[model samples]
Target: MTKATSAARDDRPPLLALVGPTAVGKTAVSLRIAEALDAEIISGDSMQVYRRMDIGTAKLPLAEREGIPHHLIDILEPEEPFSVSMFQSLCAEKIREIHERGKLPFLVGGTGLYVESVCYGFEFQGDSGDEAFRERMRHFAQAHGAEALHARLAAVDPSTAARLHPNDERRIIRALEVFETTGRPLSETQAQTRAAPKTSPYRLCLIGLTMDRAALYRRINERVDAMIAQGLVEEVEALIRSGVPQDAVSMQGLGYKEIAAYLRGECSLAEAVERLKRDTRHFAKRQLSWFRHMQDLVWAEADEEGKIDDLFKSICAIIAGKFHLDLEYIR
Candidate 1:
């Protein structure tokens, strides 16, 4: 084949995305699928990119990965910032590399924004930062609170506000800045970006995993307890001692923030753990809501009895049927 033909073929690899709420056994199922397909795993998680955040982020250790080649984890420090644009660029490179190596690339995580950006080919419009405007917003948030700041965004762009959490001050500020600079709601700009007729370069298969709500909540709570038992507190304390600021984005992640609060004597350890569980349950609800809005997702329901093998089989069937691959290879 000529160079142009090879380039076209490179843009059309089979891309598999496994996404769902946290603590829903995505890791184990993803591993099984990757092994069966001889594929590599690219983490779609925002938190797992940061080093020294293992316990709270539930990062799968090298042993648990079972010799699978996993990319995009531990690629940054706790203080470094990561964005959807960065993830899109890096993940695309990794996908091409995996395809070049004659292996499929499976994106596995619960971060809806990152996954959807890659799926739809989001063209991120760079925001020209106005340091003065940013400082003003920062002062307003500081004087009032993150809730007040998020409310400001809701007034301008309710859709973005609904998608983002109040504690996500960084994004809230950025959204506000986008509006101020462009005279358009960030949502409107994003809609226009997506409206551009850009065909995705990959043959995509999206797999979503879910379970009974009560069962999922129970699993999330149990997972939180397990993290605590595994010294989540100590992990957060080490980050803080190493000068990871409390207000940093990494510290604002699910488990890290709660544990940091406890370490600062702002809340008791028991209270912090309970708060972590509750917040994680709420986050899972939001995740489900986001996935429900995505079209063309093949959802596999995990049984209440924790039958992951059954779930894996259903996913494999979908992959084989859609991609015309043989199941015997995986078997």
Candidate 2:
């Protein structure tokens, strides 16, 4: 066998990834796969890490995890900041620990950047802080509005801007800062990083779930309604009462922000709920757009029935074929 082929078949434990747009049923499917493989789950979601931001993020509760050990959920306060670098570091450690225990590691979520960074071993070379520049950008955003700041990023890094929402002032400012400090568009730099030969560090099997766009949107809308019924407003109120700032990074999440607006009397509850649904649909679209650029993914179609058995069988087959895993343990 060729050296590359041999290395691909080396003793390193394989990493299985289940990713897709929001409400595509990734959570249920990942749990089943993890059980079948005797695996532990490492969350790829940016929002699910916060302690009390559960319902809106669609985070699986402990009871729903089916006793499978999950990493990175409920590990941070709502006011704390989290970044892709922190996720990458923590997830890598978890993968190693799972491997050491002879258990499979399943990276699961809809967050595109977090998943791709772990899959490709992205090197975070930029300094973690530029407090002065960050403050300047924040002031600029406040003075000119998020749209104007986002437009500035679009002028320099259109690809990055396209992926970020106009109101995502944090990322927009970061992208612009990357260009200003490095003299290159953030997208171009990231493309170069992804193109580097030593990118992927693990034997990875990426499984992506997709279905009819209309069906996915329907699910997203229903999920929003369910969150509302599940005391999402009360949840945000509790956080706010606990002193989580309205502009804190965690509060900027989809449901939290909209409900905060309602609680602040800036909009009616009905208006806020509708806006939340619309924004969630838009977010799911962006997720799909981002996943389209990922390489070497095995696609599975989630039917309307939501039966995970068929999908599980398909994924097991792919894992066996690509990673030469023994499936005798699965059943």
Candidate 3:
């Protein structure tokens, strides 16, 4: 455990989060960090909350978590809708419980907004969202591409789209849907909310992972292949067979959507794999863009091949300094 903190004076919950693009090995790094800090992981992933959708969501097996208790994973049925507000509320509760148990709350995932919402105490409108609109947008992105969907958002709400990554089709579509439904830009609505007393309620330490573009793309491709080998197709097939709608929010996740298409006979397995690789690459790029736009994130370069220990040490150093505590840098 880190030492030398003014913990008695500060009342805010301490939040440590690692955010980055998928396939950048956030999970691998997080396990070591969490073990060192006596932290319980609260999954910041948007897709990992659903049950029976493990491989496609890249959920590390419970046996592989090294005994770190994880929250917000596999808590929801596929048909049950999840919203940002729901996540924010649930995560806040988890943070408190972890603190009560005298352990650090570690938020780990590649989902940008989900992590950011918890970090900043972001408030949202009462609207739960239009699932049909979102499904239409997802279909549009699947048919045309993420960039095209982003361009549509740019046309409707350029300010929101400008900050959002092109491959962040979900948020882009949300921005567009907000415009279409309310005749108001989501950016403007957010601006109005910022005028309120809304602010971060936690003492957040955020670490962002980055890598060389080519290197990361290679990893993304390799990850897609690994998932295929790990029975990702079978996982999606099981989900579909179990009555989860193809258009369900859970089904729209990265690997699940592509593999679902294959299971539906919409595309050959080979084609789905290639598309998954390409789309995941695009998704990783988008994640990088989103994190860059995010403030207060300490950047860390991750190289899976060489200098990995150095990267871990540097990240530990950042966390120690940011939180004003000593870190052991050991599991």
Model 2 agreement with the true structure over 1-331: per-residue lDDT tens digits: 1012223436656789989998899888888788877889999999999998888888888987889999999999998988888899999999999999988889999998899989988868645667789899999989998898989999989999987777777778888888988899989988876656644688888988998999999998888999999999999999999999877879888899899989999999999999999999988898887788788778888875688888888888887777765566466
List clashing residue pairs in candidate 2.
none
TM-score winner, 1 or 3: 1
Clashing pairs in 1: none
* Best prediction by TM-score: 2
Q: Among all windows of ten consecutive residues in candidate 1, which has the lowest summed lDDT? A: 1-10
lDDT of every predicted structure (CA atoms): 0.87, 0.86, 0.84
List the candidate 3 regions with Cα displacement exceeding 4 Å.
5-8, 128-155, 158-176, 187-199, 327-331
| TM-score, predicted candidate 3 vs. hidden true structure | 0.84
- Model 1, 29-82: lDDT tens per residue? 899888888889999999999999999999999988999999999999999888
lDDT (10s digit) by residue, model 3, range 1-331: 4675664576688899999998887888888888888899999999899999888888999999898899999999998889888999999999999999999999999888788888888867786678898889889999999789988888878888877656556668889889989999998987665445535688889999988888888888888899899889888888888889876778778888888778879899999999899888877877887788776889999986645678888988998887888565434
TM-score of every model?
0.91, 0.92, 0.84
lDDT computed for candidate 3:
0.84
| Top candidate, metric lDDT | 1
lDDT of 2: 0.86
How do all the candidates rank in terms of TM-score, highest first?
Answer: 2, 1, 3
Candidate 3: pairs in clash? none
